[model samples]
Target: MVPKRKNSLGGGGAIPASAIVLGGGEGRRMGGNKLFLAVDGLLLLHCVLDRICPWFREVLLAVGPKDASSLSLLLEGRSWASPVRVVVDRAPGKGPLAGLVAGLREMDSPWAFLMGCDMPWIQEPLVRRMWALREREEGVLCWEREGYLEPLHAFYSRSCLPFAEEALARKDHKLKSFYPQVPVQVVPEEAFADLPGHRRSFEGINTPLQLERFRESR
Candidate 1:
């Protein structure tokens, strides 16, 4: 969905960067395209974009080639603060790694916030703080409890594209497999607790039960 852009933005000015939302996931665990599930009154993807567009200069939806035609006209009114464009995966059936590679290749901005479309509760303060650290490394993400890293909730520079493509070429699609090839700044999970929604920013609704749980919790 390409929402209408605002005439002028006013909140401390949006960060000079772009956002790449990974909408290309197969979503087999959810039965179908979970991004189409209703959230409040809007489609899940719209809810995610509405909040995100206000904080970035441009927004890109990295979707699967099969979904390309349907998603091309998902939005038709003034619902976002920035312009949005859709880029299809060059290699369909590949995971988020392929989507990220396609997004980075199409991205014109030096830095971009990359995430999954299932995330509609991303907090602005968390995003702003992360944007401030854009130049600190080739990639920046939050490290969760235990040994897990929240790769989806991160900022990636265009410089990481080559390494990502390298991984994709070798068929090592694990999102973090390419991390070792690039410089990364790991934001401690404690610092994440300082935000409004805390770790909610990293949580994604990947299944029907998880979506139901989120709806019931609200």
Candidate 2:
């Protein structure tokens, strides 16, 4: 049987979800830059955008101004093919919470699928599954094996904007800290496995070694 879908966004045809590829991380563990890392012959950022572009109405990338020019050069004329927009973070080096706030505030759609740019292994099918299951809950986030939320790769509603903004204002950057204040659903590993591809896609790429692993796997 098909799993129940919540919110049912994007209308009957396209999912109302707009994607926010959070590419503002410092990538310190990867020795400086990571979004530029090559994975399976594709830039990690492009691999992420390519995966989610088909599932959402618009794709907005939240990147840093320092790397904005290079990122723009990567997309150039390709903007004609998709509704891709590159937005820079106002408060840099703050963390993923800041990026999420920027994404939600800049969103023109009802829901936003937020993911880190370093995750080249994340499959589109898993993203679609999370979107389909998004409920009245503020977020449909990942339940990592270590029993923590994978805040980056998740589905957050537009309604969570206010709370998220407040969290940032209070310097409460931890995504888990706001969970008690709003509704949230954890997409367990079993449920995530229903979608095709490796179940460990939520595993983030932090070092060059991890990037090499992704290359080897491909």
Candidate 3:
């Protein structure tokens, strides 16, 4: 659960940082919600959180209205090594664009890490490595292969809020829409080689078949 909000007079006291887990997708390709899929004995969402908790002071699961009730129960009455929160999308059916707007609005931190729930292989070392490499630029995403930028696993500065809002207003829901408007730094896959098991961090679970393949490979 998101730690209780805090208010302090000292402006430099501390910055409230957090991670927003995007679990609001319709999962049309997967035929159902992929966040609940089992991976290595735990739900996919949990696996992602397990990796994220070490890096973020707080975690929020941004789910669609339809999934909030059930997801809330799962988040509640459970103890985690780190704090977590479940927030619902204010505007449903608008895809991740809406979810992101809602998440950025609710986030307490100046910098929030946006993550897709399907990437179960994200490692803590990779997160730490990326943060160290991040620039003041508005966006920083993972780059793999020749020209693949994993926008979902990225860092966003609240400074880009207006750009994101403008994109949503134009009905341009894709995450990359904000790239041109904001300075983005793409970290190549090679940069993460020092981090053990880094190659698997970009593996996203979009379909049941992919999950099976991941299981077998594991």
Candidate 4:
């Protein structure tokens, strides 16, 4: 059974939202499956799921064709706070945009939060703040740091489906390529200035060196 969604703002009510974790990357830089890499006694993917699953009614993991078996093993015998669904990219090698499209297509909620599987440092407080700011917004809601939008760590509405589809059809796989065609709310960095670890909330482990440094720091 899927767990009940709660308002991230502590309102004691159900919130209509889903969490989408993009895990279809080739991980060439990490030399292999980076999602399975162990960090703080938990796999990088699991660590991310554990932190964000409770905030949504359902959680969808977008994986590549070759990731099914490994991901199944990682999730076996484990229980989650929400129903977890695994979605494979419709078109392989199309990048994060493909994963996002696959995830949004399966989402039943009006809004979904998109997160990269490698972002193990994502903070719930910062996410809650973002969700709070997304109230009834009709398009994408993301944070901007140093003038660049954090598309992977953002909220996307089902209304973005058309734009996403258009981008894919045009062979433009950039995750933020459709932003200009939709209503986007870019949350300034100062909004999260008071949150703990706000500066590193969107940090992701990409290469082996970065992973090693992350593990050492932790």
Candidate closest to the true structure, highest TM-score: 4
Of the pair 1 and 4, which is ahead by lDDT?
A: 4
Backbone-clash count (model 4): 0
Clashes of 2: 2
The runs of at least 3 residues in candidate 1 whose Cα sits more than 4 Å from the true structure, single-residue gaps closed, are: 1-11, 134-144, 213-218
User: Where's the lowest-lDDT run of ten residues in candidate 1?
Assistant: 1-10
Candidates arranged by TM-score, highest first: 4, 1, 2, 3
Write down the lDDT that model 1 would get: 0.76
Estimate, for each residue in 40-156, the C-alpha lDDT of model 4 and write its tens digit.
787877767777777788989988888867798779888888888888888878998998999889998989889888887887777877776664558998988888999988999
Residues 73-93 of candidate 3: C-alpha lDDT, one tens digit per residue: 776676666678888887677
- Global CA lDDT of candidate 3, please? 0.72
Give the per-residue Cα lDDT of candidate 4 at 103: 89
lDDT of 4: 0.82
Per-residue lDDT, model 4, residue 128, is 78
lDDT of 4 at 143: 86
- What Cα-based lDDT does every candidate model obtain? 0.76, 0.72, 0.72, 0.82
TM-score of each candidate?
A: 0.86, 0.83, 0.82, 0.88
All predictions: root-mean-square deviation over Cα?
Answer: 6.7, 3.5, 7.6, 5.4
